[model samples]
Target: MKNISKIFMFLLIIAIPQIAFAESSKIGVVDLQKVLNESAKGKEAVKLLEVEFEKKKKELDIKENDIKKLEEEISKRGSLWSEKVKQEKEEDYDKKVKDYRRLQTDLKDEFQRKNKNFTDKILSDIIELVRTVGDEEKFSLIMEKQNAIFTSSTIDITDKVIKLYNGKEKGEK
Candidate 1:
């Protein structure tokens, strides 16, 4: 009877670990890039950035047109004027050209900075939402799809996340 009890104890110990291992872990994959591109907030951010870009582009276009006009005026009248007057006009043209170039560079830099900041902010918000979704769905682990070597479509949660993010942005909850 002692031997039977000992055998039973040994079998239970072996089976306990097997039973624990049999439970599946709930893991999910989220594609952040998809979230950024498909989410409504993300699309709104892109539109805002594009509008700002077009506004800045118009400013640069005006500066460029002014430069072209000055260049043409210099070419048409430079030969008819006295040396001093011609020299002054030439200097003015050079200054305008330099100013236009500087303005162009500055506007480009500003646009790029704004774009980077907007992208970063959106990505940060999405990551926070991903965490919240993971918690609510009882995920044991959530990984970025880009970082994973392979993940099945059944475990991909990007669409669900996007839906939740959009709903959140619209004040649905």
Candidate 2:
């Protein structure tokens, strides 16, 4: 009888802790995209990228206009000129068109590369911040809002995290 009591007590001790831990564990969902879009640092990063893209776009437009003008000049007087002059004009126009096309391709590639780099950096930072906040708040699980089909407002931590991230950006750490 004494041995039986001791075994029961041991089992109870083990089970009680597990039950308590399960009850106390907290789970939350956050909209990562929303947080990133709303955060002050994210906004600043977007603005910086936009400014750079605009400058590049303007340069591309100017190059395109120059190419168009060269093409028009060549077309208007090609047959009226001597063979040598016509051939030279055709060569110049071809070279200019090729250069313009190459420049346009490079600009597009560069813009994509820059945009991807900036997005990756921002996402990495946001993930770090989310983990830090989750650990500090003792969240047992944190899920992205996109992955979750539904969650109650009480379990939604999107707004709180955005606030915290913005606050940190403002030197309120």
For candidate 2, the 10 contiguous residues with the lowest summed lDDT are 164-173
| The candidate that achieves the highest TM-score relative to the unseen native structure | 2
lDDT value, candidate 1, whole model: 0.88
Q: Write the per-residue lDDT of candidate 1 for residues 43-138, one digit (tens) a residue.
A: 888899888789878978887898888888879987889999989988988898898889888887887898789889988988898889878888
lDDT of 2 by residue, 1-173 (tens): 99999999999999999999899999998888887788887788789888988888898789888878877877897778999998988898788778878988998898789777877887887788879978999999999989988888899888888887888778853
**For every model in order, what is the number of clashing pairs?**
0, 0
Regions of candidate 2 where Cα sits further than 4 Å from its true position: 1-22, 151-154
What's the lDDT for residue 34 in model 2? 88
